[model samples]
Target: MATTPPVIQAKITSDPVKLPLAPLLVSVVVGVVVATAGVGGMICYLLRSGKVPIRVAGVAPVVPTAPLKTHMVALEPLLVNLADPSGSAFLRAGITLSIEDPAEDKGKETNAGEAKPSSKDADAALRDTALTVLGQQTSDQLLAANGKERLKAELKSALAEHNPTVKVADLFFTEFLVQR
Candidate 1:
């Protein structure tokens, strides 16, 4: 005789089943998001705590300068000889200069209380300049029609050097004499 196979039974339960891992997984994800948000907040707070300073440049100064002082005096006369290839000639020289000081010129002190000159400063200065220039003068230079003018320039420069305190601005000729 063949024995019959045992019968299997199927049953359905009405009670709810608990999923243990689902809540733990959700908590871990939320924790990670919270930690990231906390770190971002900390970084923002640190940045806001630091200080940044600003700087600027560009400034100008304001001031004025004083003008120079000058004076002029008439020259006596200058006689120069020409150094020409053909022959010798004569030149008359005259000039005026803008001296820094009028006192350098020879004259009576206009001030009523001023004393007379103890030393011949003016005469000496003039003579010195004249001789220096006359010694170096040439016939060609003196023979020209404008010889007086050229002499005046040299005289002015020389006189000015002699009278450093006095500036020789210009030269003039009141009397001229030239003989060939």
Candidate 2:
């Protein structure tokens, strides 16, 4: 008959067990994904709250427009020196002012009736305004790409200031010649 051997006690360790590399990596990835999702949700909530006035897609603002009754008043040719110090460059421009239709203002239906202001007064005012603007511009300014359009805008403003009641709809350059 064989005798049974006595069992020995196993020793316990104080150090923690090492975790598997795969599971640790998976936990880190999950934590990052959860944090990113939380941040994105917060941003969406703030945007929807309308505390900020973010413009929505496919929405356009309204603009007011004036009635379209236009008439042109031709001004005589203007010759003026440019802003250049040596007076080497000059501008000769023939401008036409698009004024409000007199027929519309008077509520009359006439074919060839002249506008209210005398031709002499209107011509002088328009010519003076145009000459002042053209004379102030340098050769470089006149030759620039958007120079003509800028000058037209400035002239329109000046015309408005000169005659408040006169609605100058647009400015047309019948002849624009710049000599340098």
Clash totals for all models, in order? 18, 0
For model 1, the stretches where C-alpha displacement exceeds 4 angstroms are: 1-98, 102-119
Q: Which TM-score value belongs to model 1? A: 0.40
Candidate 2, pairs of clashing residues: none
C-alpha lDDT of candidate 1 relative to the true structure: 0.63
Model 1 Cα displacement at 127 (Å)?
A: 2.3
Model 1 lDDT tens row, 1-180: 899998887688888997799899999999999999999988777767664333445755656763333444455676666454444666565545444434444342356454333236775687667767765766656667887678777877777777675455555566666556
